[model samples]
Target: MKNYLSSSQMTLRMFAADLLVLSSILSAAWCLSVLNVSVPKTLNSTSGSCLLIPCLFNISKEKQNILDSSPEVTWRRGSLWSLYDTDGFTIAHRQKEPVMEVVGDLRKKNCTSVMRNLTSLHSDRYYFRIQAENSGVTGTTAVHINVSESVAEPNVTVPVLREGEEVNLTCTVPAPCPSHPPNVTWAPALGGDVTQRTHLNADGTQSVSAILNFVPSVHHHELKVNCVSIHPLHREDRPLLSHKVVILNVEYPPKETWISLTGLVWLGDNVTLTCQSKANPPAVHRWFMKRAGVEEELSISHVLSFTAAHENTGEYICEAQNLCGAMNSTNLQITVLGISFTAFLSILAALSLIFALLAIAIVMIYRRYKEPIRSETNQDQNIYANMSASAVKSEQLQSKPCEDKNTCTINPVYAFKHDLPDENIYANC
Candidate 1:
């Protein structure tokens, strides 16, 4: 902390010693300049603006303390010899009541003066003089003031361009200072070629212009073109840039059109069909119906709404048209079953009537039953089944011993249904 304080004090002491030395030198120079005069060779500013001319004069060190008394200064437009030799003199500065102001404090040996509303007529060699209480000093050197017009930003013109259309863009800059005319450039590097020329405006001002011609496409939409000005003034800093924007409005027809329905449209229900499309300039829609090989325009609106019925079943076409172009959608088949709640109730009532008649007929047939026809063979079989069980016995045979081994004598009884009832039995004859 002690070292820091010591270093701070040393820095302040050194600054004070340097300031004292500079004041002594200035004081000596002020006294010496009284014998001579000093002025700049040239100074420049724009016309209708202010000019700062650099000058220096000196007073005695004793008189320099009372500089607030306001030293008097004069600016003469002609040479010293001519002004003294000629009777008439053009005075540019009188200091108190004139527009020209002396910004320098005369006691400090600074005699810089400002000239306001500079014009071409004021571009002449001038002399500065300082008048004290009893002594006067005149400048030996002449200061030449050159007044010219200021550099201005270029005007960029971009026309209303459309796709595939030929267009031109122009950039204009006023060249009042023709020797230092500003160059104009466009950003995004447009067109066939950049053409430059100097032309005269109606107000008699000369202007330098650059033109760019091109055939604008859809890709150039909503883009900005800049007109830059490269001037010698503050060239190392940044160039002046101005821009004009052109937005293209492209025209195209409707495409990819389709229809949208509210719901599953049935008979006697209010249904809506909306036609839509994508287009630059929006197209108006109309619904067309082709029924029974006959075509007719149905509605001239974007939405077609009606009560659905069997008669409304047809090929529905959505047509879109605009000033640019027209388009038609593919055929859409719309069919209503035409079966409503009333018709469904009527069908149920008819079915119930048919079922009731069939039931009555069935009940009458059951009450009046009739016997079926039978064959005689079945009757015989049924009678035999009712006979005694002994009537179904098989016949027996008796064999006697024979002399030869291969031959035998036999006796058989051929009686059939012997125990059966006479009405059912039959004898083999």
Candidate 2:
């Protein structure tokens, strides 16, 4: 019976201990759920920088009345889980302090504070406390801080971009110190309107944002954009710079479609015509030949090469197409002559030589015919003059009645007889 009683007692004691532990855990959880202060669980800061702890608190009606009359807020640095523990060291009070200050109004339950000159040594858990003239002091939640020596890179967000569409680009940077928040700017200034804003994050770190508004164009495609964040806390020494880059991929249709020709296009000559265009996803080229009043599709490629012929003389057009859209080039007139330029020049030269030879022959024939006629004309003129003189001499002889009619002396080569009034004589000379 004694052994059984002892065993029963031990079991009961063990159950009571378990119940006690469970009750204590429940109580602690309830207290945490009803904590008077609200603050971020974690905060980030940089060495030699400042940070703001955004906080708020609530109290019982009686304590609230007292705090509204004469409230005093305080901040301590340490890790104390119990409500009655006083092991934490005071770092800031409602009064002005060198390293920390309670910037919030205690009467309004705002316990926000600012701490400056933070270093790795300042990395720890911090707690907020509130007290009034009559109201006892009350402690609230704690926040863990992490300090680093390097600045973080800025963040850039871009959206789907298209030509001729308005867009907004957002750049955000951590703002550890509100007094001198970081400055955010964009590179290659897009000539867009920029608006700035400050935000408090749930992690107790503030951020500054810059939004750029502009209309995108084909020129901005594949362009690199930069977001630069400048920290003023490091300005006294060497300024700290953090930047992020993004390349824009803008969607556009086919543009600036045109054609280029290579090699002579005269008859029987090999020639090539090339079509070109600018567009996203590239473009497919198609060629068409327009003659008299009809249009004929010629080739379906970027280049069209063929031997020049009379049938090739016409206005050529090239069409560039992509998934976005299509565009047509201006008319490219192609005239295929009957002969090549060199052959035409050679033929012209041969014709000129033949005409020159013909002219020379004509001139020579004219000179030959003219010289003979001139000689014959000169001979006839001499004979006429001789005849007139002979007539005159014969008349004179006749007038003298041939003085000695029968005794007339006449050379064998020239002998003429003149008839007188009573005598007539005829002789050969």
> Which residues of candidate 2, in runs, are more than 4 Å off?
1-27, 36-42, 58-80, 83-100, 123-144, 159-169, 190-206, 211-221, 234-236, 250-253, 260-274, 281-287, 296-314, 321-326, 332-429
**Local distance difference test scores for all models:** 0.65, 0.79
Off by over 4 Å in 1: 1-162, 169-198, 208-235, 340-429
Give a tens-digit lDDT track for model 1, residues 58-93.
545555543555557777565653323333343333
> lDDT per residue, candidate 2, 1-429, as tens digits?
999999999999999999987886666555444437788888887777788888888766644565655656656566444443443333332122327788887767777898887777777877776545754444557888788787888888899887888999999998878987888988876878888899978755689998989998898999998988878773366556789998988878899999998655788888888899998878889999999989999989989988888988999999999877899999999988888878988999999999999999999999999998999999999999999999888666656634656455453256545445333334321
lDDT of 1 at 13: 100
Please state every model's RMSD to the true fold in angstroms.
19.9, 14.4
The residue pairs in collision within model 1 are: none
Q: In angstroms, how far off is 13's CA in candidate 2?
A: 9.9
**Which 10 residues in a row give candidate 2 its minimum summed lDDT?**
89-98
> Candidate 1 local accuracy as lDDT?
0.65
